[model samples]
Target: MPQANGHANGHANGHVNGHVDGNAAPLPADLIDPRQVKLHDALHRLRKLEAAKDIDIPQLIVVGNQNSGKSSVLEALVGFEFPVDNGACTRFPTHYSLRRGEASTTAFIKPGPGRNEVEKACLEELSRSIRNPTSFHDLMRAVNAGLGKKVGMERTGDTGKGFCDDVLMIERRGPDLPQLSLVDLPGLFTASSGHQTDEDQETVQEMAETYVRNKGSMVMVIASAQEDIHCSSGIGLIQKLVRKDASLNERTIYVITKPDMAQSFASLKSVVDQFRFPRPAHFLRNQDSGRDRPRSLASRDAEEEKFFGSGEWVGVPQAQKGIAALRTALKEMLWGHTKNQLRRLIPAVQDMTEEAQRGYKRLEEAGRPDRRKFLVDVAQDFDRLIGNAVIGNYVNREFFSSFDDTSLEVRYKRLRSTARALNKRFATAVQEHGKTVVIGRPRPSGRPHGSAPPPAFLAAEIDRLYSYPEPESKCWADYETWVAGMVDDWRTGEPRGQASSMAYWALFEYQSRGWKRMAENHLKAVWMVIDRFIDLALAEVCPDDGVAEALRRRVMDTHVDKLRLAASTTLESLLSCHGRGNSGFYDSLDDPHTSRSRAQALISKIAELPSLDGGGSPRNAPAL
Candidate 1:
């Protein structure tokens, strides 16, 4: 059993700590611990899964304003001088996954699935170009060229600007490295410059937010202590995100760069002590400060040691002082987050497995060669659906029972309810209008007659005949005039009998016209219900494009059209008989000889009409 390395313990005491003395040599090959190897292997597995499945792995995101020493902090931690330049060096997010292994660096592009064949080919070509770059500088140049060429940003044409949301993943493994994953986002900018427009600024902000806003990510907001912290745009953005989700405050860490250049130590200490930001703040002094020159690894290590050993910083806690400390903290935080994320990931994997199984089962069922059985099953299903619709038994309680449930089933129920309500409204309109026809009297005078006048049959007939003025109906008016002339001719031949028959015919025609209009409205309402139900059923039964088209042509379209035509014909015949041929019409009248008895009988008949249930279906519905 070998002891784990300092990197595995996340204590920042191995190569980083050993280098502080400026004389500690690299760890020997025999000293490479098993525990450290296991951790690295586990992380590597996770990275592979994340890449292959496009899963989100837990990460620490380092974000700061341009020229705020973000690159310096990263270089200090990784001990690698990443390519840096003036005027927006980073146009894409760079992810560094550090681990302890053989001393080597490798880089690759991770494009999203939305990329086209051309973009994929371009990226592959770019990857090969920098496959074994002699230096980081060569790697950076290749990356810029690839991005600019693919996005058409190398030219000033109308295609695109230089900015993109693509990512570059670099894996650096060395005997001295810590087990950590870090994302370096594009630096925040206050204004547009050169080809960068206001839109470019927005793009950068969106990219930064996309990383830090991930619940699985731990955000590190970096700012130079020499600059007013208030001006740190990155800090303001982090604060805004934290405000929306206060739980983020627990995971966010603050890094103050260029601590050696601060104007007043007391002010800096006060800011740290007050903890106004409600997150731990660490102060760091990079190797090269206030100079344009680059220093060697040994020189950088000496600088860090000298600063931490000085009286100014020696009193500060080890956890809040150097790049090594930052690395340790990030490793520990990520390890914990990864454990929790893995626990959550288990259930998700199971769910995905079950869904896949279901899909496979469907495929197997579809592949069955028994075509006749499949057709028979489909026909039976359709027949059951039609029966349910007609009888109003298809209402799904899960959907219709709750107003909050807004599924398709609920919508279909509401549509059917509307059609039924319209039918009831049609019935009510017929009943109400018929009452006026039966009463058959002139507009009532404010003063009532002392006694009811004997049924003025002749006067009532006259009033009812002209009551419905059909200005738009030239043919109807002509027909009514011809009927009235026939009545006059009959009146001349047999005065008493013809008058009685004329009054009855006038009332009959008036009610028939009103009932026909109402019945037509009801028929239209039924047709709407049938049409909508068919559409909804088709969508549910045949959601796939190929199947839906075939089903519509072979079954739904033809079946629904035939049903609609049959329903229309049945309704027309029913309405004609009910309005013009029913014997009940005579019994419901107010003839002088039997007015009182007829009124009593009409009330009893209405009482016997079947009631409409909550499902909108009529109980004991009369046969049409």
Candidate 2:
């Protein structure tokens, strides 16, 4: 690693192009270009602060089909021939940052997902004193080793998963370099054979797609002239995005590699025609023909020149032929691209800054809370929210957002409303089937054809109440006779006159049985609503999901359950008074007509049903 190395002094500076070196010394003004330096500086700060979540930094990315000479193209641009031989596929992306400064190189591994903390620390230490392409291979070996992969295994894990999002960064500063930022991504592969599997193909494809989607990044799509362009996944990938976002047509550079070996230049005619509209214009370039062949940047350029100077591409424009011309065009385009992207970048940063400011101001003036007090405050807040929900007070916008977000929650959180709804439905059901005998109205027949059914969310009480069988009717001549038949026979010690009164009480008691059922059901229904409200209230008041769940289990589950049992017992005891289970059926003996008038009203209510005696038996039995 060297610092402040520049080419104007005329020496090979032992580094890639002057791109994004963060610690490099400033170059003299006469030989300076600030676009790459300035852009990279902003990105470096953004990344260092970890504030780039909403922004896309400008970069150059290399992507193409597998074995499409993608690595060769990256080498010509970045000026280093990496170790891609001996089954060394680029298993992950390599992000190169080169700058014009003193001669030096710094390399590091950006650990990918799923690594343990110890592995991350070890991988982080690989950056020290790395100066060349072989160091890159060593870094990959370290990543694989930390991943517990054996020495010879280059790609897949034991589970057959291959490729990673881990990025290898190499920052270099040298005299021979020009300022440029570039990334070499894994080549897109299709067939899942050998070390690579179906998973590997999807991983590489996704990685390629993600890079291309970043509008700030310029995509260089490398295609081998020897292979059919139609089959090239790199070209196909970019073309797909271009169709969706037409502007990417400008950001994409379709470069044809290995032209020296291509049997027919005419095969790429369609690709050339479709992609050449906005042009730096060249698609053909040759960097190397064999592994570890072109050792220096000088030799790589020489080979490209030799190939184009003769043969099929000789007629191709000088502007459209070699790596030198391609490099110049990319530099010019990237400068303009950086300027345009600033329009979007500036606003995003301003928004992020404004959000930070609001966050700071939004904090309470009180200092850090005591642990005990924090728990108490959370409990009080939950209590207040539950109180509000029980009373139908939907004043908190935040609570409403949580409670009404989904269709079910919208109508469930308000406890009072849920109770009222249950009560109304229960009242209607009682009216239809409450009396043993009705004078006018008949029970509804089976569900009407094509008619809408009751709401799917009706309370459990409603369904249970309907499921029990409707009572049958029997006939008797008059009230006294009916009472005589309904009464239990007088015991040996009991008086005969008291038998008529006791039997009459039993008759009226049996008729009011639906009230006990409905009242008991209403208690169960309200408790059901209470359970749902507690869940919603927890979400609204206690923002921490884990705490809300814990509170529900520890407090609400244990205590609320006991409260429900107590409440149900109290309601059932009260409701049992309506039927024979309580002391006795009480009615006014003062008005002689009072009992008869009430009995007549009951008859009118069920006039459509079979006529009935006020006592247990019907005067006219229903026909079979």
Candidate 3:
């Protein structure tokens, strides 16, 4: 059996050279014990190979939902009692690699994805202090300790982390251990409870998904015999995954744990038959007596042999009975998977060679050609890059490869994505401050803003609009005082009843004119983002400063100015137009960019006016 090595995006333990030939000797086609030191050396070497992620490495990943007898099966397989019975459960992934040698157990921790250098170093240091684990219980404690002790982090209440994706790797060289290794993942959870949240459940689910999705990973899905098939989330996951890739059916194995605890053999068969278990499921009852005392592997095998020989399991083949047999079955499965990996070795090397040769040709090119032709190429490249950015295409691997978020090079390269984010923020700003007036009753005490952003977009503008302090002529005071003067201008000699009726329309028009001003501000803001994006795009497209500047001034600047002017002209026409041709609907907005909440708030306050819903010459305003 080979030891499984850890590899993250850009980190690895070591590198593998050409073909299947490297520091590791060629593995024989015949079945080998999975716990051998040589197999692990080969796997660890393969994991560090250049472009190794493109190749699927053989592994047995154990997965199940929380409290689904997942921990029990792992304990039974290793014959080392886990501390799960004492409130400690598998919170993070733990990968165990076993081999035969002078009895020694050493362990380490692999940082989870996205941990910074400082945190990774802290985890690595945690491993250095832990040279030996006297038992599996102590090994589990060390793992939890490493996971909980994040660098520069402090907390209270619980001593351990809620759930983490960080991996704990263990290597055991002992005279008594079996010849095998398996990856035990954090169990999937059904719902949020206790310290775990819905987010935590999702995290664990995704982690299990990552393992089972791997083509070379032989999944040991532990399904509880006592629970309904539908209730077991792991069964559901396997079902969906197998549907997507039918070949996953070949690698997946479902094992029913706690066969003795089921209501009856018939009831247990009902749970087992619900799912097409990929391969025939092996049913076994893990002994509960281990809880009071540690159970050795040899005793477990003897007890299982007697238990199966006298019961309904008597007819079951030796290949599908007990944890000891399952371990052998898994090792044989690995042997076949390894041979499959070797069959693709030569072709993989050929592809790598061709890709490298092409890369070399690109690197060797140098010197310049015709300046005009160069400029033309730059312009075409610029157009293509912009087109892709507009359409959200990232096919060009040269510049659009790395997504280092802090780099402006990466940020501006994604033109459409950047625009979408800005557009969302722009809409948010309009929703908050575009009204220029908030005419609702004062908010209730202790109530906070709900989902809506604060009026920070145009704070000064809103303040100036409401700055009216005159006795009988404030905009905030009600439409009456402001409309009183305007009412006389529109209908000087008309009856007071009719004059008051015209006041609502007058107030509506007065407030509507400000829409044009806000529209202009938003327009400028949009063009500003696009304009900055163009500059960044040009720099990337044409490395020559002179060529880039010439294009910016001659082509980009002129087209931008023309486009901006045309947009401004169109906006003017839309605002001023009022005729039969206008259906008053635009796809961009449900109600012409007017924030509906603000509009309703305004209507509620003004509904009390004598000219609106009041008894004195009550009249309706223009259609909103």
| TM-scores vs. true structure, each candidate | 0.51, 0.50, 0.51
The residue ranges of model 1 lying beyond 4 angstroms of the native Cα positions read 1-40, 50-54, 86-88, 102-104, 112-117, 155-161, 273-275, 289-294, 353-624
lDDT of 3 by residue, 358-418 (tens): 7556545632456557777887888888888789897776766655443555655666666
TM-score of 1: 0.51
* Candidate 2 lDDT by residue in tens digits, 184-302: 89888778886788877898898889889999898888877776667889878987888889889878776877665555666555556665546645654544333323245555566
Q: Please list the residue runs of candidate 2 whose C-alpha ends up more than 4 Å from where it truly belongs after superposition.
A: 1-36, 102-134, 148-161, 265-271, 274-281, 287-295, 357-624
lDDT score, residue 198, model 2? 86
Overall local distance difference test of candidate 3? 0.60
The 10 consecutive residues of candidate 3 with the worst lDDT sum are: 2-11
> What is the lDDT, from 0 to 100, of the residue 307 in candidate 2?
70
Model 1, 86: alpha-carbon shift in Å?
A: 5.5
- Model 1 is weakest, by summed lDDT over 10 consecutive residues, at 2-11
Residue clash pairs of candidate 1: none
What would the per-residue lDDT of candidate 1 be over residues 1-624, giving only the tens digit for each residue? 221111111112222111222332232222223444575466467558522264556677989887677876766665555566533357788887777777667787877444543355457657767655555655666788787865334645544346677777777666666566788887888788666678888988988887888887888888877777878888888888877888788778889887776777777787667647674677777544224233454456567667877876878888888766676676566566667777766676667669668766776787766545665665676566656656666454432346566554554545445455455445434433433333333333331222222122212321222123222223455657755666666453445534545445554665456655556544544554455566555555444544555676677767665765687688788766754534245443333324545666766665566555435434443331
CA lDDT of every candidate: 0.60, 0.62, 0.60
